[model samples]
Target chain A: MPVHPGEIPKPNTAWIWKTFWIITAITALEFAIAFVMPSSTLRNSIFIILTIFKAFFIVAEFMHLKHETKGLIWTILIPMGLLIWLLVALITEGNAIHEAIF
Target chain B: MSTISPTTQAISDSALDKPRTGTWDGGNEPFNASYGKLMMWFFLLSDAFTFAAFLTTYGLIRHRYQPYTGTPEAFEFSTAYWPIPEKVFNAFPGLHGFDLPLAFVALMTMILIFSSVTMVLAVEAGQRFDKKDVQKWLLWTILFGVIFVSCQAWEWSHFITGTDEGTLMNDGTRFFGANLAVNQYGPVLFADLFFFITGFHGTHVFSGICLLIYCFIATTNGTFEKRGHYEMVEKIGLYWHFVDLVWVFVFTFFYLV
Candidate 1:
């Protein structure tokens, strides 16, 4: 059979193996931060950072966003980006409610 | 050796050479689905909002408890106040006699995380059209999801049972122990937030378990293999992973913080 000219190679088996390794490493790092770090702003910062990294790996590789089109990634990521704004607005509203009751 | 006709060859070549689209979708335009892959993206987007709302509410309640803020033990739930998380959620396994903080919840978190690995393997098997492997992975995934849900249920039972015999005061109304009544835990609001946040996330885990069961059934039936793609597994995997992701935040905001 004739081959396609521009088509990318089908992702190899190694992709799954590599994905596992990355996820394992990120999870280990998260455990370390949670267990070893003394409570502080620094520990919190590290925890959040590692969490974001773990999330990124799952989204990019296991979810195959890296293989997706720009339109798809944006469709997914833009809303997540908006969550920051959502958090601020919701938290502010929640605070107001707390004030009224308190 | 040039045995195939030119038009037939051209059609085959075109099928092979088609430029890949930019989207993560499976590119099956005829069915109006790029494949179920893109569904994961959208699902995650919606899920993120749900979790964000819960965590933000938690923050608001915690911030209100600021001044004269006491240590974990000081925030104990008497007939008058709400208990602190470090105090409430620190149940260790039997025989430890030591109060380890966030122990069971931490273990639950690991269970969900490991379940995610099994889900990915299921997806990988689906891609290869390996029915046996798919069945194995999906079974393991379902088992793990069920275990995670059971753990959550146990925690909820403990939370609801409270220290005393399930009677608590809240804003002058007598509420049951299962609820976040006033004086059951420092502020009436703490139990309110805890129930709402963890409850919603637990519901998600429940649904994820259902989804996993369905996936397992479908895998055993060889549906995806017949469809010639395993995108469904990947799509559901996104939902499973998102459930785990939300737990991370819940653990941070509810337990650790």
Candidate 2:
């Protein structure tokens, strides 16, 4: 069935365009940090900050979870949460293997 | 239960039926998704986990070797220590004079990111039933994807056989200096990690290229036009964006960190 104007909600294209521009700017900042920053501490902080920003835009906008139902948001979020756990667990395992190899 | 019972109900039923024959109604079920869109989301979800695992593993390994490999490039630290990412990834095609540092990989990253943008634009155009825009943007996307894959293959070959003459480690060990193995550039374990992390990512790029081909064919055949929608564009957009997202992580963990 075709979606009626009343049935399906429309997303704000202006907001999407704004978010896209912001991400592009953030990417430029990230490149600067990677190449020009003299202080490693400052560069590391900037890199992590920009990375989180990019991830936020990806999950909220590109994935369309921002406008989705709570159930759908939870569906994607729960797996993402699990991935955090998996990263910690598996990477620790990889480290142990590295130790054994060394 | 009120006085206006069966007769009132009959009136409301007919009233609701009035719009049923319109173009917007006509037996169409709300929220019915195309297979491609659904599958794309599922694939991206799984791919996200795979990439997260790789980066996390890199983190763990780096941390475990902290004090030894940390401050790898510090001026006080011996030149014999610091791992130079630029030196490792430098690959120029049939050129002399100028030595490029990660230029090829950086270009590949840009291509994938731009293709992702084009893909989203294609989806937008698809929604508006703009077949010409969809075709144009998708062609650009396919071209970028193919170029990215080719560059990756060149990089892989460079890493495997390597360029210039170098000695093999007596024990078949591989390192980063005069010896075919083990000199500067952190623990030898990093080479293994490099191969695994990038090989897995290359596989994703390869599959994405295949999906783009399928999308290109479907668009050429007027499939989306006949369906009166652009669900396929949305599906491919998900896959394309996921590829870009993974690269963001790879760039940080592999290069910056």
Candidate 3:
């Protein structure tokens, strides 16, 4: 194929492998924490935070979203704010329903 | 196509007459990404919301019950209480009868993470125009995806079959596994959400595998070479990464949490 100067992504193999290790380590940390820390609200919250951290890497490094323009990045992220609202609002309603049932 | 520079192809001839500062006015590649790639990103964002809706529903349903407050060792599966994830997904292949909570799903997570790594490598190779490496990485990615789906199938079967220590229900019959009707582990909704959520993600993985196969075959036959770019491979890579990303959330909410 002739080189016509297509958008060439930064072809850094080291970063890919580095990302793999970082993701794997976070998952390993998650699994270890599960065994030692008994199930509780705090433990579940920690799990959610770690999961978000891992998600950032998968999107940023693997999907190449990090290198995308900030405009593009915010374009995707800003709407997620509404999703957070959805989670909070519905979960609270669910708790109210639970109070009625029990 | 080969004669025209990528920049020329990206921006139309009329746009060249206009000022570069007026990005929105004409075709000055503002994001520096192709139209196809941008569409894929938008599509994935919509798909993310779909998954979010499913998960949010699960959270709402889960909160409707009083979560079992007992210690993990003393916990008993019942319809009256929310099930602990580790208590439900404990069995591992060839190592049954042992309580290795969260272990098997962890292995599944590792497999998915590795597959994402292979996907990015394929994208890298595509950018470099290394035909052989692109094909190699795509094949590896497809292989891992198949393995991941197979693991999910096995996990589903284990979930449906349940264990010998089935929970005794209110009626006196011992319910063993899970189905649309009842899960011995917890409320019927627990089993319902598990099937709906994980099954949906599994379908995405299955479709991703099919897309990868087509992408792989296209790469081998020199389709991309003639087209002068491997943007198709890059787009598919984005889809594959999104699948892996969804699994990360699924793993957190369904298994470890």
Candidate 4:
């Protein structure tokens, strides 16, 4: 398993290009929505969803999280899942508080 | 031979020196990842939470100030105290008379994402031990990062200087520029959150650029060549991608939402 100096490892370049295009396309869609779509609940939801989708590609492909072992991936993703839950709960609670006081 | 007790013999065999095997063995990386990579993932996970917390607070405060209900059209013209994101962020650089809402920030987002692509390409080149390609892509990524930061500076200056000599509120207060106290944009909290969230993300981008520069230098000096792997490039690539990932969320929460 020893490596020699200046030895170039063969890499799969196809995935890189595919991911690049996918990210670019998603971003283009986001920009389109921003301009054409009016500000509304549905628009906000779409923005959130698309943002998460873009995040997934960056993490999975660029960061190589998808190539990691399940244990490692879960170690990262599980906490993020909990964080999302926390976000939902807090925002809901914040709304309730706002309604009660104001 | 002197009487060697079992406990003494076991003590003499250092645990660190022992050959590890099975589930408890160090040989079995639970996630089949290197130590550095695993640590980076953990760090990013925590950082994500920090950003989520900030955005969540922003949502809470925004909802409190501007409670929109019923039809979207009604809410759009509801005359809420909170500022509309598009209205506040409508300015484009050097386009004084034109109102290009979100166009410039959108361009900034594209630049950051494109930089992320270059970072990935750099990592790919590193995998192949293509020093020249790695350096090339890294430089490109750095250049993009610099451009994004400069664009941000211009945006901030424009925001601070105030358009149309600031907004005159019904409360008989003339609001101008942004600070911890007041902002001409709208509610004070909006400007505060905007500065804090984007400022934090900007710091990350700055540091990511610094890391890329260091990697570029090391690559030129044949450091990774001697190591026989471009793991350093991959590690920095993870960080660079995380920065871009955070910005995606920031863009959604701050600008688009």
**For this target, which candidate reaches the highest lDDT against the unseen true structure?**
3
Going through the candidates in order, what fraction of the true interface contacts does each contain? 0.27, 0.26, 0.79, 0.71
Q: Comparing to the true complex, what docking class would candidate 2 get? A: acceptable
Candidate 3 CAPRI level: medium
Ranking by TM-score: 3, 4, 1, 2
Tens-place lDDT per residue, model 3, B1-257, is 44467787667556664445565766577578788999999999999999999999998999998888888888878888888888888889999799988778889899999999999999899888888889999999999999999999999999898898888989999988998987798888899999999999999999999999999999999889888889999999999999999999999887877
- Which has the better TM-score: candidate 2, or candidate 4? 4
Candidates, DockQ: 0.26, 0.26, 0.61, 0.56
> How many residue pairs clash in all the candidates, one count each?
15, 5, 0, 0
Alpha-carbon runs more than 4 Å astray in model 3:
A1-11, B3-26
iRMSD (1 decimal) for each model: 5.6, 6.0, 2.5, 4.6
Query: Which docking band does candidate 1 fall into?
Result: acceptable
* Candidate 1 lDDT, B1-257, residue by residue in tens: 23457887788678676546646653435224364555556667877887887787676656545322455444445533335456677655462445676778878977887788788878776666667778898899889988988888888876776543334454555444556544355566777887888889889989988888888888778676556566777778888878887886777667765
Model 3, DockQ value? Answer: 0.61
Per-residue C-alpha lDDT of model 4 across residues B1-257, encoded as one tens digit per residue: 23347987787578865656777757677577888888888888888889989998988887767544443333232224676666678899778967677888989998999899889889888877788899999999999999999999888888777777676666877666777677776677878898899999999999998998999999999888777678889888988999999998888888888
lDDT of each: 0.70, 0.67, 0.89, 0.82
Off by over 4 Å in 4: A1-12, B1-25, B67-80, B170-173
The lDDT-based order of candidates, best leading, equals 3, 4, 1, 2
